[model samples]
Structures are given as structure tokens and as C-alpha cells.
Target: MHDHRRLGRELHLFDTDPLMGAGLPYWLPDGAVVRHVLEEYVREVERAAGYRHVYSPVLGKRELYEISGHWDHYSDDMFPPMRLGGGEGEEVVLRPSLCPHHALIYRSRSHSYRELPFRIAELGGMYRSELSGVLGGLTRVRSIQLNDAHIFCTPEQAVAEARAALGLIRRAYDDLGIRAARYRLSLPGGGSEKYVPDPELWRRATALLEEVLDGIAYESVEGEAAFYGPKIDIQITDPAGRESTLSTVQIDFHQPERFDLHYIGPDGGKHRPVMVHRSIIGSVERAVAHLIEAHGGAFPVWLAPVQLVVLPVGDAQEERAHDLVRRAEARGIRAELSGPGHGTLGARVRAARLVPYQAVIGEREADAGCAAVRLRDGRRPGAVPVGELLERVGARAGDRGAELWAAA
Candidate 1:
């Protein structure tokens, strides 16, 4: 099995320390670079899809979750409330989820029917209190940076919005090279306390999700649904063949009622809006963990921590290598210079094998103002002009291409 924990440490991607606690691993510089690129890509996609981004506090008052039923139904996985000053001070807790805060955002102002399908997105942090034994690597963590969003739309618009969300999830999976093991229609199980007790609401919400998943192959799984609603879970299998959800699309009717969310209808009366919750990539940490294992640390060109490494064969070529680094950086490539001090040309190339592109500036190539190029896949494109090299790399990274070179 290609375990991410092993690969992450080998690649200097992330680590956990005893002082910092388990399941709270911190990202190394290389890992941060990959994560930043992934996050920016998600933000750009959401912005283009009409989602208005927002920032919300990670701490919410106890009453906030109580109103959303997290305090009642899901408090075991939530951190205990912290009293601000003394015992009498107001109680606040690290939020277990972002939906409550987003519900508050939706009720901040009255809206008209035209603005019914208002979408809000955030790459924000939330905390979960997990049992010590179950916590492992990035997959299960105490803190999570979620790629979460909520779509507030009319009942009539709910299906279309949910279907669009599924489409978006598929697009993201394709770009990220993630293969879905299966789609699961998660429904409430027999435990009444595990889910909201409104049978009619559950029925309606489940039907809406079923419609959104129309013609899609999925297994209906009881007890896997969110406490407030049913959802479409996109499941991915790890190298060990263990399956877990990586993305989800859900229809929520409960939160709108809890928050009293309404918009002016065409009949000049207030009508309730449905909340469609979707996450394209569930958590930044888990997503990167999956990517690390999926690619075995040789990430796609666009997401690679160091896209290009410029190597100088000897002291004579150091100046040229430095110049090439500067030019590549100017072109938005994550370029670094590995000088002769690192080792022999072959040794340095081997050291940076995980890097997508390696441009070797030797005596002959330096004089010719070109580079002897080698790809991570062991393809030697031979000597290519410096300008052309930078352009090819920049274009490939920008396009998020899986192949290092255009032709291949």
C-alpha cells in the first residue's frame, strides 16, 4: 500500500510532533506550496461558478450550534464549550461545522426571489474532537480546512443547483486525477437521535437528492447521512483499497427552518428556501493526502511543489543556472537552483527526480544559451533554448496538464 503518512514524511510534505498533538500535523514548505496551489484553483473554480466567498470565525457561541441542532445531535464530536471570562461568562466553542455560521450569514438580510439561489463558499477551518485511537495522518484530524459551500435556493431551484454541484465535483475529480470508487446515497438509519425526527422533511430531502442523482449509479446506504439531511457521497479508494468519502452534495431543508430563512416570493409573501450543501474537495488536508498517495509525491506539473529545478553541471555553469532560475521565476514557475555543491550532475538530477522538469546547464549548453532538459518520467528532450524551455514549462503548469510536454 502507498500510505500517505510514509510518502508525506519521505517528501517533507507534513509532520506531527508530540508537543503539537496527534492528528494535527503541520504542513512543510513543499506541502504548503502544493496546498496553496490547490486552494487557489478551487477558489477560481467557485468564483467562476457564481459563488461569493466569505470569511467566518472558527468559534461560535454555544447558542449558535444549539439553534442548528449540533449541540443536541452532534455534540460528542465537538469540542467542549469554553467560558470566556469566569463561570458566568458566555460560552463559546470551536465550531464542529460551517453550516450554522453560513445559515446565520444567509439570515443577515432579507432577500428577494431573484436572489434565491445565492451561493456562498469558504475555505475555512473547523475543529472536531476525535478519539485518540482513530486519528491518523491527514485523513482524520482535529482541525480541518474545509472546501465548503452552501446554496440557498427555492424548492423549484434545488434540483438544478444540486445537479450542478455534482457536475462540478466530477470536473474537479477529473482535473485532480481522482478515481471514484462509487457514489453513495446516504440516508438516515433507524437511530432517531442520530438524525432529525421530522419524517416529512427527511422524505422530501431524500427525494430531492435522488432526483439530483438521477441516472447515476449509487448504493443507498442507511446511517451514513448527515444528521440534518441525506446526501450524495462521492467515495474514493486509497491504495489499500479502503474507501472514504472525498466529496458530497446534499439537500438540506432543516437548517432553513431552524434559521427562519426566507425570501420574498412572486406572490409578495415570504417563502422558505432550501439549503443545498456541497463540498467539491472535502478537506484540504485529506485531499492533499490523497493526492500525495495518488501521485506518490510526483504531483502533476501544476501542483508540484517545485515545478522546475535548474542544475549547473559545474562552477562554470553556475551563473547561467542562476539566470535561468530568475527568468523561470519571472514566468511564474516555481524554479530553484541546485548548484555544484549539491553533488555531481547525475547525483543532483537523481535528487530532484520528483521534480517535474530538470534543466541542466552544462558548459556546452551554457555557451549555447540552452539547457539539456530531462523530465521526471525519464524523458530527455535534449538541448532546448532557454526561452522555449521556460515557455513550455509555464504553459504546461498553467494549463494544469498531466503530461509534462504538450505532445505527450
Candidate 2:
């Protein structure tokens, strides 16, 4: 089995230190490049889909979770409150979730019926008080950067918004080459204190999710729902055959009621709006962990940290190789020059096998004003003109295409 934790270390992707604490792995430079690219791709996709990004503080007052019912219903997973003063001081805590702060943002201003579906997205951090025994690599982290979003819409618009969120999730999965194991309609279990004590609210929320999942194949799993409501979870299987949720779309009425969020209807009357929560790629850490295994560290061209590496066959072609690297970088391609100092040309190419593209510059090819192009998949397209080569690679990377080369 291709394990992400092992590959992560072998590839210098991430590392965990005792002082940094368990369940907190820091990304190496190359890993940070991959992460930054993925985050930018997500932001672009969300921006195109009409999601307005926002920033919110990671810490909130202790009473904030109390009002959101998290303190009462889900406090066990939260960190102990940090008292500011010695005697009877105000308390604050690292937020376990971002929805409460988002609710406050929604309530910050008045809204009209025309702005029914006010979508807000954030690539924000949150903390969880996970036990050390449960801590692993990126899959279970104490500090998580979530690709979270919330939509406040009228009751009539809830289902449609949720369906759109699911569509976005599928688009992201396709782009990232993620294959979901299954789709699950997670419902609340019977007589569980972990869940809110409101059958009618659960019923209404479950119905909304069911409608959102209409005609979509999904399994109804009890006790898998969020504390506030039912959700549509997009499940993925790891190399160990362990199934976990990677993406989700949920309908929540509880938070709206708790926050007393409302909008002005066409009749100029105050109307309660439903909150739709969704995560396209879920946590960045878990997503990267799965990707490390999925691609086995051989990422797609657009997502590869080092998209192209230029290898010089001999000292005579060193200048040409450097020029090629410069040109490639100028074209916005992540390229590096591997000269004789690194070793033989063959050895250099082998070392850069994980890179998506390799350009070999030899005396003959340099004289001919072209270079031999090789793909990570071991396809040799022979020697091509230098300008044409960079253009093609840049275009492919820009389009985020799965294929290395465009059609003739």
C-alpha cells in the first residue's frame, strides 16, 4: 500500500517535531509550494463560482461557543478556556469551528430578499483538542486549515444552494483527480446526547438534504450527521481501505435560529434564513495527505511543485541550460537547471523523475536551437524548438490539463 505518511517523509513533503507537538506537521518548502498551488486553484474555482472570500479570527470568546450550542453539545472536543485575568476574568478559547464567527458576520448587516443566497468562503484555521493517541499525520491534525464556507438563503433557496455546493465539490474532485468511494446522507441517530434535542428540526433539516440529494445515489448512515443537521458527505477511501469524508454539503437551521439571523422579504417582513454549510476539499492537510498517496508523489503537471527541470548533457551546454531555465521561469513555469555539478545528465534526470517535465540540452540540440523533451511518464517527444516547447508547457500548466501535451 502507498502510505502518505511514508511518502510524505521520503519526498520531503512534511515533517513533525516533538517540540512542535503531535498532530501538527510542518510543510517543507516543496510541500509548501504544492499546498500554495492547490490553495490558489481552490480560490480561483470558488471565485468563479461566486464565492466571496473572508477572513475571521481563529479565537473567540468562550460565550460565543456557548451561544452557538457548541459548548453545551460538543465541548469535550474543545480546548480548555484561557482565562485572561487572575480572578473572575473573561475567558477565550481556540475555535473548534468557523460557523459561529460566520454567523456573526452574516448578522453584521441587513440583507434583502434579492441577496438570498449570500455565500461566504474562507480558507481559515481552527483548532481541535484531539487526544495524542488519535493523532497521526495530516489526516488527524490538532490545527486544521479548512476550506469552509457558509450560505445564508431563504427556506425556498436552501435545496438549490446545497445542490450547487455538491456540484462544486464534484468539480474540485475531478480537477484534483480524487475518486470518492461513496456518497452518504448522514443522519442523526436516536436518543444521542451528541445531537441536538429537536426531532422536528432534525426532520426538516434531513428533508432538505434529501431533496438536495434527489436522484443522486447515496447511502443513509445514521449517527453520521453533524450535531446541528443532516449532511451529504463525499467519502474517500485511503490506502488502508479506511473510508473518511473528504467533502460535505449540509443544511443547518439550528445556527440560524440560535443567532436569530433574518432577512427582509419582498413583503418587507422579517424572515428566518437557513444556513447551508459546505466544504469542497475539506481540510487542506487531509486533502494533501490523500493526494500524496493518490498520486504517489508524482503529481499532475499543473500541480507539480517543480514542473520542469533542465538538464545539461555536458559543461559545453551549461549556458544553454541556464538560459532555458530563465526563459521557463519568465513564462511562469517552475523550472530549475541541473548542471554537471549535480552529477551525470542521466543521474540528474533520474533524480528529477518526479518532476512533470524534463528538458535535456546537449551540444547538438543547443546548436540546433532546440532541446529533447521528456515527460515524467517516460514519453520522449524528441527535440522541439525552445520557444515552442516553453509555450506548450506553459499553456498546458495554465489550462490545468491532465494531458501533458495539447492535441496537434
Candidate 3:
């Protein structure tokens, strides 16, 4: 229910075309950069967390989901099957999640107990069938690029993996200046109709969840879990009392077994491994929506697309301004030259659209070969070498590390 209309329009970050099938966001040039910045940051963080990245096809064979228990257990969340070949014949579904594919990958190789803990990360674009009323802007959408990972490990390794995931989540939230966030310790099935078959496994799973949650003091309630597992949700409550879950770490005891996945034990005997499904930043689209609302259109210098715009005060200073632009570009700074959009130097600075930092290069500053750099922080680092300014932005980028490894 947050009003994103103003930010969406003013920033020109996203466009929702009614004719292009609503709920799909059209990322304008600037918006795409923001998206890439986030995606790159997250990929780097996940790579450092002992995760091996993988790519999977969006469409899957029907048998794959059937063996993974997704077809029978969580059917409501998936998009309808696409019929391939000659007629309305064979059924193949657009994957709603990446667990089944990752399961197939594990089964593809015979794993050993030494590889007991294997994490696979995939930045996959998934499709879902959303209710009509729920589809609007980026909050609820039909398509999403998700930070999907599946951790295969022995039950004993669960706690360590879960703790590491929590640390990453916290780091991300802190870097983004996200406060007022907490974890919802999702309990295992409590004999409700909301839960699935297999009561004994549910009890064992809940016990595992309790063990992890107790250590973190994560508050939990019953019946909040997926039919197959217990999960920890990272979320926040806004001033309007509306709550949103941004990330999830689920301990699944059922899926691996459903697919009959196993690893060779030290005894050379076959043993089942547990699966932990997680998304630290959840969906890129939804996270952007959260940030758009949370920061209220003021992205930090780290994530800003066009960090600075150089405006030459007069025609005589064009060469100097262009030189500064090249210097900023070399440092990976998204800088631009202000053309004839504004008549006067003062007007150009005032009308610096979609750009936070504006450097005014007149005769005096050009002679000094320095940039009169302005900060989005409301202070100007006047007369600075382009290299010095790049160092400052680089430091800020490192500080604003992605939300996945940090927490939502």
C-alpha cells in the first residue's frame, strides 16, 4: 500500500505499460544500472560464502517437480504449464523456484560425506501466477530475478549454515542503513490443515528450527512454514503497521528425501542429506520496491546511478569539463556533461535532473585543473582531483555491501 507513484515517475526508474501486460517493470536506462549494481554486489557476496553459482533453465520437465514434491506440495504458487510441440500435448512448467533444479544438479553427481555441505547459488528469472488484485508496480509481480540457493548438508551441519546465512543478512541490512528489521522464526507444521503429510518429520524439523532460533533469540509462531519445512523470514514493519518479508532461509527435511537424494557416508553407506533453501535479498524487483520506499527515493552514494554530473559554466570551460568527465568515467563514476538544457550556469545546477552531484567548471576552476565537486551529502569537496573523488566513492561502495551476506 505504499505510494510509489511519485518516485517511480520522478526518477523514471521503472515504467509499467498497461499494454505490455501489467505488473512487469520496464527498467529504463538508469534503473537498469541500479539493478546491475545490486545483482553484482549480491553475486560477489554469495561467491564469498562458499556457494558455487549455477544456471538453470526456466522451463522444467514435469517429472522433475513431481519428484521434488513441489508439484504436489506447493502447486498453488506455480505458473501453469506450457504445451510444447505439435499440439496441446506435453506439459512443461515455468519454474516457480530453483530447488528442484538444484536437486537435479546434486543427483547428477555422486557426492561424498566430505562434501556434506554443498551450496549452489543461481540468479534465476522465475515466473509465478499472481492474483490480479495483487499485481502492481514492483511489490507484487509475475516475473522476478531471485537470489536462489540450495544448501545440501547433513542434519548436523544445519546450524552452522543457518548461522552464516543470518550473519550475511544482518550485514546487508546494516550496510543499507535498514533499521527496525527482525526475524520471524517460522515453526514446523503443527497438525493444522495448512501443513502437509508426514507428521513425524515435521516434529524433527521443528526441533531443528528451535535449536537454531533459540540461539538467535528469533521470535517464532506456529503454522507459518511452507508445507515441507520450517523457515526464518527477515522482514520489517513500516510506520503504517504494514509488514513485508524481504528474505527467507528455510530448512527443508522433506524435499531431498522426496527426490531420493543422498551422499556417501564415511562408512561408504548411503545417507540422506537435508536441504536448506534460501534467498537473502528475496527477489530483486521486490527488494528494489522495499528500498524505494524505505529510503524514499534517496539512494546512498554507493547505489546511485549517476553519482555526479559535470556542468561547464561557459563555452570556454567545455574542454575542462569534458576532461573531468573522462576522469570520472575511468574511475567507474557515472558522470555526464550538462548540455544546452539550461541557459545559465546557476540554472543548470538547479535543474540537474536525476543527478545528485553537480560539478561547475568555470574559467577559474579550469585554470586550477580541479573539479568543484558537490556531494549528495549537502557538502562540497571543492577543487578536488578526479582520482581523490573516485577513492571516496569506492570506499562508500565497499561499505554498502549487498544485503544478502548482511541480512535484510
Candidate 4:
């Protein structure tokens, strides 16, 4: 098994400093690029699924969580509330999840039944107070930026909304070539005061989630549900065969009631809207960490931080290499040139393994307007035309292709 923490340091992906507090990681430039690309891809997917994006404050008034029932159940996991001014000032806690803020947004304006299944999404930062013993690397951190969304629909529309969410999950996994080992249907256990007091509501939520899960193959696990409701969790097997949750689609019955959220029906009657909570990519940092380990730091071509690096053979070809870098960038390939002085071909190629493709431009190849293409896989496609190389790489990235190279 590849140690992601070691890879993280060696690859300059991220680092944590004691001065900055624990469980907080500062992303290096290379790692930041990967995160940016991943966030963009996720945005496109969410946009296509009819999710309207929004940005909400990272900290909400303590009363907000109180109304959402998070204060009672999840407050221990949240950061201590920040008290401003004197005793008169209200306390604000860093949001542990986006569900309540989104509920408030849904309640901000009146919605008719026609607007049912309203979806609001955000790539929002959250804070939690993880125990020091469990805090290790990017996988378990106090600071998390999550791909979170909440769907507010009529109770009658719950099944269709869940089905739509499952479809979105499947499409995203297919795009990234991620196959979950299995699905886990997590339901609330009885007699847990942490769960909401409404037994019938729990039954309804559990039934709805089970109906959704029954349509797909899944295992049932009691006592794993969130305080609010039941959920479907995707369990991904890492390269080491350890299963971890990567995403979830949950049915929340408690939050709507806690917040007294409602929408108007066709007959002009007020009815509570069901809340469906989902995290497509879950914590972005954890997802990236998983990808780093799964691919052994050799991300798929489209997702690699730096897709191509130009290695000039000698001083004579340095300018040519820089020009090619610009040309590659113009074609939408993430390209960079080696530092001023060139390194040995083998050393440069080895360093370029951190990237997906490397082009060693020497006097001969520069003069021929081509590059000796070296893929991450140990294959050298000798003297390919620079234009053709750019076109092919760009196409792969545009299509989100997984392979770096294939036999032709």
C-alpha cells in the first residue's frame, strides 16, 4: 500500500504547521490545481443535474443550529462557538454541515408546489473538532470543504427526488471511473434520544430510503443514520482493500420540522417539504487523498495536476521548450517548462512522473517541430509532431479520458 502521507510530502501536495493549529492543512500549488480542477468538474456535473449553486457563510448563529437540531446532537463535534463583543452578542459556530443553512435558504422565499424538488448546492467549508488521536493527514481533518447539496421536495416527490439523486451519483462515479464495493443503507436505531422524537416520521423516512435502496443492491446497517434520518452511503474499496465512505444521499425528516420549513401546495395548503441531503464527492480533501493513493500519485491524464512538462535537453533548446510550453497551454493542456538549466534526460523524466506526460525536446526534435513523447507508463512514442501531441492530449482532457496512452 502506498502511504498517502509520504506521497503528500514528497509531491508537495499539502502540509500542516503547528503554528496554524492541528487538522488544518495548507494546500501547495500543485495540489491546489488538482483541487481546482476537481471542483470545476463537480460544478459542471451538478449544474447539469439542475442544481443551483450558492455560497453561504461558514459560521452560523448558534440559534440556527439549535433550530435545526444540530446543536443538540452534533455540537460536540463542532468547533467552539465564537462569542463576539460582550454577553449581548450572539455566538456563531463554524458550520458542521450545510443542511440548516440551506433550509433557511429554502424558507427565504415562498415556493409553490410547482417548484418542488428544489435543489441547492454548494462547495462549502465546514469545521469539526476531531480528536487529536484520530486526526491524521487529509483523510481526517477538522477543516473540510465538501461538495454538499440539499433537495427540498414535497413528501409525495420523495421517491423521485431520491432516484434522481442516485442517478447523479452513478453518473459522477462513472465519469471518474470509480466503482463502489457496495452500498450501505444506514438507518436510525430505536431508543436513541439523539434521533428525533417522531417515530412515525422515522418510519416514513426509513421506508422511503429502503424503497430507494431496494431498487439497487445494498446492505442494511442500523444505528448508522444521521440524527435527522436514514441515508445511503457509498462504500469505496481503496487500493489496500479498506472500505471508506466517499459519498452519501440521506433523507432528512427532522430538520424541516425543526425549522418549521414549508411550501404551498396546489390547493394553497401549507405542507412540510422533505429534505434530501447529499454529498457527491464528500470531503474534497479526502477524495483527493483517496485518488492520490489509488492511482499511486499517477492521477489519470485528465485529472493530473500538471498534465505535461517540457524538458529541454540543453541550453540550446531551452527557448524551444518554453515556446512549446506556451503552445501546449494555449491548447488547454496544463503545461510547464523545466527550470532555466536543463537536467539529465533520465532525471528530468523521473521528476516528470509526478505529471502525466513529459516531452523531452532536444536539438533534433526542436528543429523537427516535434517532441519525443514520454508517457507516465514506460513508453516513448518517438518524434511525434508537437501539434498532433497537443491535439491528442487536449482531446483526452476535454473528454475526461482516463488512459495516458494506448497502443495504436
Candidate 5:
């Protein structure tokens, strides 16, 4: 397997500058393209799944986390709080997770039991005080953007919401080419102080989680759950056989109680709502890193930064090259022109292995109003009409086609 860090640098995906400190990466244009496409796809999926996306601030008062218990339990992983207005204002910390923020949104509004299963989603950027020793490319970083969401539902709808979240996770895994993953039912250990102090609550939450996991194949692992509640962690095996948690569907019984999140029930009484925290591609950066290694930096056409490069055979075709690139862009394709002095046409084409397709524009092809299309997979479908090229490429990208050549 290719090392993602090395490939990331070589392909201009992302880099870390010394001035910016460690564990924080700057996404280059190419990397940003992948991230943008992934985010768009995720938003579409969540929208269809009845999730309403929202934006939240990066920093919140210390009390915000105190209520969520992160200030007490996970402060070591969080950045130190900052005092605003000469130490008179509230102490604020960079938000570590969106759960508390989403909870606050739910609490800010009045809802009936009919709105119980309301889901809020966000691609929130977060900060963590990760040790420099553990920092690696995009996989492990201090600054991360998470595809996070919280579902506030009545007790009766909690399991259904959890199951629906699993379906989303599975769909994402399948779409992204992630395969053969196992589910781990993470629960609190017996008498562990890391977990909440309610035994009955833990039992009831665990049983609900079991009901969801029992419907599917999973292994129960004690002590692997979050401090707040039980969860199901999706463990994915990379190409190198290394397993890592790509996503999670967690049920939080403690936080709702702590934050007093509630809705009016059929009995006209306020009751605590259950919060289900889940993420399909937990961290956007980590997901990109994983996919880079999996595909050796040759991202799918839809996710590729420069899907097609126009290489002019000579100065005679330079204008035509630029023109072709313009036309491709007008058609909503990411295309660029390669100038002379870099290398021969063949050499430039070969150098662009990371790009999905290369179109050679020369006098013969320009006169014929066609392009010599070459696929990354060593197949050259000679002299295709420009219109046909656009149709094929656009369709593949629009459909999020994964192959270099759909017909191939």
C-alpha cells in the first residue's frame, strides 16, 4: 500500500508548514477539491435522510462544555480555555465536538413529541490538543472537520433513529469502496468510573443498543463506549489490513439528562429526549487520507481535482488546447491545459497519472474537432469528438462514476 503522507505531498493534497505548528494541515487546491466533493455528496445524503444542516461557532463558553461534561472528563484532549474581555467575560474554549452545540439548539426551541426525531447535522471544524508525537498527515491532526450530526428523539424512536444512522453509514461505506467492516458494540465496563453513574440507565441504554446491533452482525466490546453512553463503532480494515474506527453511531442517555433536553409528550408532560450522535465519515481529512492510500492517490473522477488535462502537441495546438479546456470547464468539468517546455506530449500525459483522463490537442485533432482521449488505465480511445468527450466525462462525473473509463 502507498503511504498516504507521501502520496498526499506528491499530489499536492495537503501539507503542514512549520510556521503553522504541528498537527495542523493546510489543504492545497487538489485536496480541497476532494473535500468539497465529499462534503457535497454527504450533504445530499443527509438532506435526503431528513437531516437539517446548521452552522455553529467554533468556540463556546467553558460552561458549555461543563454542562456536556467534556470540561471535566476530556479536558486533556481539549485546548485550554481563553478569557475574553480582560478575564471578566466567560472563558471560552475551541469547541471539541458539536454535540453540545446541537443540544443547545434543541433546547432553544419548543417541540412536541411529533418533532422528537429531529436530526441536526454539521460539517463542523474542531480543535483538539493532540500530542505532537502522535500527529501524522491527514489521518491524525489537531484541527479536524467532522461530518457530525445529532438526532433528538423520544425513547420510543431512539432505536429506530439509531438503525437509520447505521443504514447511512453502510451506504457511505459501500459508495466509498470500503468493504468488509465489522461493527463493535461498545459498552461501559462493569463499575467503571469513566461511565455515567446510573446503573439502570446504562442497562437500559445497553439493551437498546443491543437491539439495534442484534439485528445486524456485531461484536460487543466492554469499556469501548463513550463516557456518556453505549455506541456502535464501525471498524474498517484498510488495504494494509490495519483496522481503524471510521465512523460511529452512539446513543447518549446521560447528556440529555445533564442538559435537560426535552420535548412535550402525548401526556402533555416534559420528558428528556435521547440524543444519538453519529458520523458517516467521522473526519473529512482522515477519510481523504484513507481513500488516498486505498486508491494510490488516483481518486475517482468525480472527486479528482483535475479530472482532465489538455496537452498540446505543439505551439500549433496551444490555442486549441486552451479552448478545449475552456469548453470542458463550461460543461462543469475540471480541466486544465499543460504548456510547452514541461516535457513531450507523451511525457506530460504519462506524468499526469494521478489525473483520470488526458486529452491531446494537436493540429490533426483540432482540425477534426475531436480529441485524442487517453484513460489513466493505459487505454487510448483514438480521436473522439469533443462533444462526445464532454458528454462521457460529464456523465461520469455527474453520476459520481468511480472508474477511469465507464465503458472499460
Candidate 6:
């Protein structure tokens, strides 16, 4: 088993407690840094794709689900409603998905075919009434922050839009050095209560997915689709020979009709629009957990919670260490200073706790105006210069952990 508790505490990442209940994770300073960096990268990428970011309230009115079919289909995964104050019975519910909210946005506005594909994205929190027994670490939690996006598109734009979603997933994975990710078309279950009653829509949507998956490296997985629609689920394998679903791009054929949503067409007549649902990077918690394990806590410099840890060789050189920290911080590097312990050995030991980058600040280097950087990146190391260390750090940061410095 992975020593998540030890690593989380020692690295100052995150933790869980019996008192707080299970299925929930509490992120400490280090873990939250990972979240912030990951969110920055995700938003940057999504924005480049012309996706408009938006937010919806975490708690929605109980009746909101009745309009979205979530009450009938997804009630099993939802938290029970809360009766607020007095006179209110089952009045509030934690939203299980953003589709309902996005649908409302679509209904709130009038649009023409010219503005065909309206991509709305959010890095929002979703809650599930999961069994406390099943909760582990970040991988399985009651609360999840996901990269969710809903696209309002015409039938003709469906194919290109699907490709765009695929590109986003691929690019994100590639940036993270997840070279083995593959897509699976999650299809409707045959004769199952999980499926919506419309067989014709399922057929059309599945066909469109197959066409979209054409020439793309993907496989078809049966009975894996969400009840509402078929989806292309992205998969990634860990070092332990276990695989899990990471991201998804789903197609909805019936939600538009259910929500009574439509757009003006080239013929100037009302026509139904299709919904393209997508989540790249899946849940922020799960993704961070996998990264920690995959890289064994020795994160790439770009993703490192502490990109550079400067050690003051002695009390006399403490001022220089502080200056170094400021320089790194100014350059957007997550630099930290250490004067609590003396000597390079203490610094090395303390830096070892984080699994990367150490610098020694002694009188020799302080006089030389350059700190000796020890390249202890989970492997053999000795010393380099401060400026040289920053160059390597900057390069790794640019890579976004795509080609991280792994021990050969």
C-alpha cells in the first residue's frame, strides 16, 4: 500500500481525519500549492480553446433536479436534501453536476446558429453522498473539484467539437507526461434501468461517437456510459499495473429536449441543439494523488510545491538566504528559505523531506555572490550554481512536468 499519510504529512501536502468523517480530504499548504498550479495550467489551456469560464452556486434548489432528470437518474449518487430554517422541507441540495446549471444558461439567452458552439467551462466543486467506508485519500472523496465544460452545439458542429474536446484532453495529458492515455467510447447499457428510454437517440449518438473516434487511437467499452448519454472516457495506467478513468468527453442527445432548449437556424426556424459535455484533468484531488504517486513525490520543478529550498549555511549568512528567496519568488518560483538548521548537511536533510532541489549558503558562496545548489532530485547529486539552478528550474517549469527530470 502507498504510504499516503506519511508522505502527505512529511511533504505538508494534505490529510484526512476520523473526526472530520471520511470521503473528505483536507489539503495543507503544500497540497493546496499543487492545486493552485494545476488550476492555473488548466485554465490557461481551456482559455486558449475559446472556452468561457462561469460559476454556479454549489447548493441548488431541490426542484432543480426535477427539470434536469438528475432526480430520477442520479439520485443514488447525490447528497440528501436539507430543510433550511422552518417551513422549508427538503429545500436545498448540493449540485451533483453542472449540466443543469449550464442548461439554464442556454435557456436564459437567445442565440443564432452563427454563435453555434458556446463552450462554458468551470473548475467547480461537486459533492456525492458517498459511503464513508469507501473513502480513502484524494482518489476517492465525497467532494470533488472537476474541470467541467458544457458546449452548446449544432449537429453539424458536433464532430469538430468532439475533436476539439479530444485535443484538449490529449494536450493536457501530453503536458503532464501521461503518454499512455487512450480513449474509450462509453456506450449505453442494453435493456438496463440505467439507460434513458429513447433507443433512437442512443443509436444516433453512438454512431456520431464512432465517426468522431475514427482515425483516432481509441477503443470501445461496453456498458460504461453514464445513463444520460454515451461518452469518450480517457484512461491512464499507474505504475502498479492498475488503470483508472481520468477524463471524459460525453455527448448528450436528450437533455436539450428535456430542458426545452433551442436555437435559431440558417432556415430561420427553431431547431434543437446538442450538448457536448467534457471534463479534462478529471478531479483535482485524484489527479494530484496520481501525480504524487507517479513521480513518487519528486515533482517536476514546474509543478513542485517548493521549487527551490535555500539553506543558510550559518547564522551569519541568513541575510543572503532571504535575498535568494526573494529573487526566486519574484521570478514566480516557489522558493523557501531555511535558517532553523545550520550547515549544508542540515539543509540537505531538510530538503530531502520534500524530494527535490537544495541550495547551500555559506560564507564562501556568500562572498562569491553565488549559492552552491545541490541537485538532489531524488537521485545522485552534488553541487551547481544558483543562476544555473534557476535555469534548470525555469526549463522544467516551462515543460509543465511533461518531460520531468526522472532518475535514469
Structural similarity to truth (TM-score) of each candidate: 0.99, 0.98, 0.92, 0.96, 0.96, 0.92
At residue 289, give the lDDT of candidate 4.
Answer: 86
Distance from true location, Cα of 25 in model 1, Å: 0.8
Which scores better on lDDT, 2 or 6? 2
TM-score of 3: 0.92
| Global fold similarity of model 2 (TM-score) | 0.98
lDDT of each: 0.94, 0.92, 0.77, 0.86, 0.88, 0.80
Q: Say which prediction, candidate 1 or candidate 6, comes out ahead on TM-score.
A: 1
- Those runs of model 2 whose alpha carbons end farther than 4 Å from true positions after fitting are 85-88
lDDT of 3 by residue, 1-408 (tens): 445555766787888887878667789887788788888878888899899999999999777778777787667888777788865678899987888889989999999999879999988988888888888788789888998898999989987787788777777777665654677877654556556677788778777767767756567767678777778898776546667888888888888887889999999999999898888788998777777777666676677777778888788888888887888788777878885545787677666643656777777888877678765545666776656555665555556643211111
Measured with C-alpha atoms, the lDDT of residue 9 in candidate 1 is: 94
- The sequence of per-residue lDDT tens digits that candidate 2 reaches over residues 16-97 is 9999999989999889999999999989989998889999999999999998999988899998999987857899999999
- What digit string (tens of lDDT, one per residue) describes model 5 on residues 281-353? 8999889989898788888788889989999899888888888899999999999888677888768987897
lDDT of 1 by residue, 79-136 (tens): 8999988788999999999999999999999999988799999999999999999999
What lDDT is reached at residue 29 by model 4? Answer: 94
Candidate with the larger TM-score of 1 and 3: 1
* Root-mean-square deviation per candidate: 0.9, 1.2, 3.9, 1.5, 1.6, 2.8
Q: For candidate 6, list the clashing residue pairs, or say none.
A: none
Best by TM-score: 1
lDDT for 263 (candidate 4)? 89
**Any runs in candidate 5 off by more than 4 Å, and if so which?**
none
- lDDT string for model 4 (1-408, tens) is 887788987899899999998889999998998899889999999999899999999989999998988888888899888898786687999999888889989989998999888999999999989999988788989999999999999888888888888888888787677787899998778668878777898789889988887658899988888888888999987777878889998888888888889989988899999999988889998888888887788887778889999988888988888898999888889999885354677777777776878888888998999999988888788888988889888988888777766555
Model 1 lDDT at residue 73: 94
> Can you tell me which runs of candidate 6 are displaced by over 4 Å?
1-6, 340-347, 353-355, 378-392, 399-408
Report the C-alpha displacement of residue 395, candidate 3, in angstroms. 3.6
The residue-level lDDT of candidate 1 at 30 comes to 94
